[model samples]
Target: MENKIHFQYLIDGDDFTRAGEASSDIKSKLKMMNINPDAVRRVAIAMYEGEINMIIHADGGTIDVDVYPDKLTMVLKDTGPGIPDIDKAMEEGYSTAPDNIVSLGFGAGMGLPNMKRASDEMEISSVVGQGTTVTMTVLF
Candidate 1:
């Protein structure tokens, strides 16, 4: 591709049924674009985890994805109760998800970690009471 392709998605808070829609749609779009399969997988996994996080913790958010010739970037922004400790949140098996979400097999405390692992690069910014924004990039 010679130019960047962009996509935006709105996540519905507390809606497990619609949690993965954004990732799925992005996956399909990437596939149709003939993007590298591995890159597509990375984007899908990372974005899906972020999507689920929004539903479980942030009460939904907005995801913006940019597809470039050399990489794919995803920005997940939420206005929910922001994370108090980003370092703690990034650790595996460290989750703030409630019992109800855990019961549904949604929160295993691996969301951010998995997102970081799947993406080539990841950055997170948050304010304790305001919100959080996560930016991730995967090389194509």
Candidate 2:
């Protein structure tokens, strides 16, 4: 594609049923565009992890994706009670989700770790009481 394509999605917090919609949609779109399958899979996984985090932690959030010929970029922004410790949050099996969330089969503390693993490049920014934004990119 010569021009960049953009998409925006609104995530509803605590809504497990629709948590993966955005990622699914993006996957389909990428496939339709004949993008690389591996890149699409990586983007889907990273985006899905971010969406789940927005639902379990932040009340809700917005995700913006930009598709380019050689790369895909995803921006997940949430207004939740921002992460207290970035280093700790990045650790595998480290999660702050409550017991109730755990029972639902989520909040396994693998969200961020998985996201990082799937994306080629990732960056996170947060303010203690305000919110957080995670930006991830996958190169094709």
Candidate 3:
């Protein structure tokens, strides 16, 4: 198998139904690559959370993934109402989502926490009116 592979996914804004598609596809690819189950699940869960966040908070975004022998790296970039306070957003059970989103079984305030828990490292950068970018890495 190749030592590395690259993939990109475009998230559709406000499309909660399709939010996890990219992560699902990535999981399949990892399975085909014969990667460890734990590694694949970590990557999938982290990426899925990021994907949903991009849709819910950032309108839409692009996900770039680099699959390697011993690690997985994902970059999620989006242009929307950027985070006003990253520290607050990172706190568990903190969410700025509207009531409607909360009704859909999402926006449970678990996205960031889940992503952080699933990845070895995660970095998020944002500007109030500009945009946000989240980078996550999981070690196999």
- Cα lDDT of candidate 2 equals 0.94
Top candidate by lDDT: 2
> What lDDT score belongs to each candidate, Candidate 1 first?
0.93, 0.94, 0.90
lDDT of 2 by residue, 1-140 (tens): 56799999999996788889999999999999999899999999999989989999899899999999999999999999999999899999998998888898888899999999999999999998899999999999
Count clashing residue pairs in model 3: 0
TM-score for each model = 0.96, 0.96, 0.95
Q: Relative to the unseen true structure, what is the C-alpha lDDT of residue 129 in candidate 3, on a scale of 0 to 100?
A: 89
Ranking by lDDT: 2, 1, 3
lDDT per residue as tens, model 3, 21-68? 999999999999998999999999999888888888888889999988
Q: Relative to the unseen true structure, what is the C-alpha lDDT of residue 23 in candidate 2, on a scale of 0 to 100? A: 94
Ranked by lDDT, the better of candidates 1 and 2 is 2
